[model samples]
Target: MRIGYFLSCEEYAPDQLIEQARLAQDAGFHGLWISDHFHPWNDAQGQSPFVWSIIGALSQAVRIPVTTAVTCPILRIHPAVIAQAAATSAVLHDGRFVLGVGTGEALNEHITGARWPFAEERLDMLEEAVDVMRQLWEGDFVTHHGRHYTVEQARIYTRPPAAPKVYVSAFGPRSVQVAARIGDGYISTQPDADLVKQFRQFGGGDKPAQGAFKGCYAATEDEGVRVAHRLWGTSGVPGELAQVLPSPRHFEQAAQLVTPEMTRESLPCGPDPAPYAEQLKTYADAGFDEVYVANIGPRYAEFIDMFRREFL
Candidate 1:
């Protein structure tokens, strides 16, 4: 099981992002995962840098592989653009860039003035988007006309020897089935063994699967909760509606239910790295090829060092 970390969506300046990636590599992390968000989930947690620019800097700053933990290719940006960007980044990194993608949420997708598609419609769109991206990445003159996308004699000149691997971010049966059928691999936040089995059964082969969890290396649980709530309190919301809401402010509104007391339930925070390693181990044991850790705060260098000593 490979260990990596999620650069926080909340804290850290642009340069700090690359510096942390460098630190993760120096500490022997196998890869780095970064989130793609147009807006911070809340004003209290305010920082969402353009992730592609950060990837460009990381191409020069670190030797480890980097993946967008999940980017939405179907919306905000066209699949053609995503295909081009991923191809270039993969080439720049000498084939160390993996493209982790998903259907995306309203917070980011609705910005295009397009109505947010229903869940089922979103799945269909993702399927078409993936098809379009793969076609364009092949370096052929693509002339595709699909239900959700259309391309006319489109060609991506700087295609890598092989396209960067496409990893699907899925959390449900339908999505898992789509990932297995089309994706090179699978990515999920929950390390559910059954879901992994479903993906493999559906056709995901022995290719890599990734899992991510949140943790904070702090002196006390209280500190960890403060940081965790500041970063990811919306996990406590009871239903999917809150998650699919149109704006990040809606998340902040729902996250009000996530008190510091609930933070213990949401994150694995402690003075030592044992809990972090233990949580990550669940993903490995579930057969994930890679396990990503999302530090709840800007303790990247320190957490990388401590986690390496304790787990890696």
Candidate 2:
């Protein structure tokens, strides 16, 4: 499986992210995945720079292909706009960019003051948005009047030689089906073999499947767990809470119920490489074509070095 580094926009500044991309490429990582968010999950995570600007910088900084771990095109922005931005990103990356999209979360999309729709409704909107984006990427003047969106005489003038592949992110069976039906590839955070099977069964065929996981490499497991808890404890917040939380403060409130132990349990935290290797193997064994790993706190250089010597 191809191993990539995941850039967390919520936790690092734009320059730091660009630097990480260079470091990752130097360390022999095959690709990069970046989180696209309007806001961080909690105040402790701190930063959420405009992802498009960072992608532009990444194109100049590294040769490796990059993908938005997942961008939500259904709510905050119209699909046509996302299509244009993605097309521009592909041009900047010399056609080495993949567009990963999802149904979205209220934490980011609700900021536009639109009511958060149910998962089924959001999935429907995602389907329509994908349709609109694909139509726009064809480089023709198009008029679309769909249930959730409308585009009139829109054409993307600055498109790349070829449109980037669209990977749909899904966590459940229904969404997996949606991804199989509409996406060029599939993306998820879990290493569930059943989900991959479902995706392949539903026409995904030989399309690429990607998975991601978070880890913290530190001098000791305790330090890693502490830092991860401070910054990413929100990760342990269960179920639909992540999709429904309205703001950072709301996420913080919900994350209060999450303990440091939970964070440690969920993420591979420590100096030992065995656990990290084991975690990554789950993805590979589950049939993922690629897997991206993210370091939770500082010590990124150490993490990359360890990855080279131990995991890579």
Candidate 3:
């Protein structure tokens, strides 16, 4: 399985992201995964730069492929605009860009005061959004008036020779089925073998399925746990809270129930690269074609170095 580095926009500035991309490329990471978010999960996690701007900078920073670990086109941004942005991005990256999309979280998409829809409605909207984007990417004027969205006389002029692949990020069965039908690839954070099988069985066929996990590289496991808990405790937020929470304050409140032990158990933490490698092995066993890793705190450089020396 291919290993890539996930640049967490929720925790890094644009320059830091570029630097990490450079580090990951130098360390032989196969590709890059940069998140697209309007806000950090909580204040402790800190930063969320405009992802499209960062992607533009990344085109100049590295040669390996880059994907938006996941972008929500159903809300926050219109599918028409996202189509143009993605097209420009693909052109900038010389066709090495992939647009990984999902039904977004309220924490980011609620800024426009749109009521957060239920997961089923959101998935339906995602399907329509993907349809709209594919039409625009055909390089002709498009006018779409669907149940959830409307676009009039829209066309993407600046585009790569081929449209950027749309990889769907889905967590549930219905969403997975929609992803299999529409996505050129699959995206998930878990290494669930059954879900991977369902995706292929549903319609994904031989398309790539990507998996990811988070880890922290610290001098000690305890320190790693502390950092992970402080910065990304929300990673432990259970169920639909992550999908429904509307603000960082709400996420912070939910994160209070998460303990350091929970955080440590959920992700690879500490100085050893072995746990990280083992997690990758698990994804491989689960049938992932590619897997990415995100360093949960400030120790990303060390984590990337160890990966190069020990795992790459």
Candidate 4:
């Protein structure tokens, strides 16, 4: 399985993200996956730069392929606008960029003051948005009027040599079906064999299936768990709560119930590479073609070093 490093935009500045991309490449990571978020889960993790600007910089800073772990095109931005941004990104990356998209979370989309749609409606919007983007990427003037979006006489002038592959992110059966039908590949956070099987059976076939997980590498297990819980406890929030929470403050409130023990159970922690390797194997064994790992906290260089020596 190919391994990549995930750049958590919610926790790092633009320059730091670029630096980490460089470090990831130097450390022998096969590719890069960067989160595209308008806000951090909570104020404590603290940073969220415009993802497109960072992608532009990454084009010049690194040679490896890059993907937006996922971007939402239906809410805050028009599908036509996202098409243009993604087209530009593809060109900038020399066709090495993959546009991974999803229905998105209220934490990012609600900032536009738009009413957050229910999950089924959001999936419809995502499907329509993908259709709009694919049409725009064809480099021909296009006009489209769909349930959730519209585009008129739109075309991408700076198209890449080839259009970037669109990967759909899904966490449930319905969304998985949508991804199978509309996406060139599939993306998810979990390493569920059943999900992978479902995706393949529903038309994904041999297309890539990518998964991601978070880890915290510190000198001691306690130190690592402490940082992971402080920065990513929101990850332990159960069910579809992440999809509907309207703001970082709301997420912070919900995250209060997420204990450090829960965080440690969900994310691999500490200097011991054994747990990290074991966790990653779950993704590989689940039939994921690629897996991306995000390291929590400030010791990025050390984590990369350890990853290269012990995990890579």
C-alpha lDDT of all candidate models, in order? 0.83, 0.93, 0.93, 0.93
Worst 10 residues of 4 by lDDT: 146-155
Clashing pairs in 2: none
- RMSD of model 4 against the true structure: 0.7
Question: lDDT by residue for model 1 over 260-286, one digit each (tens)?
Answer: 778786678867666776787788788
- lDDT by residue for model 3 over 200-285, one digit each (tens)? 99999999999999898999999999998999999889999999999999999999999888988887888887788789889999
Error of 3 at 216 (Å): 0.3
In angstroms, give how far residue 190 of model 1 lies from its true place: 0.2
Q: List the residue pairs that clash in candidate 1.
A: none
Residue 127 C-alpha lDDT in model 1: 87
lDDT of 2 by residue, 47-118 (tens): 999999999999999999999989999999889899999999999999999999998889999888988999
Residue 1 C-alpha lDDT in model 2: 93
The residue pairs in collision within model 3 are: none
Tell me which residue pairs clash in candidate 4: none
TM-score of candidate 3 against the unseen true structure: 0.99
How big is the positional error of residue 272 in model 1, measured in Å on the Cα after superposition?
2.3
Clashes of each: 0, 0, 0, 0
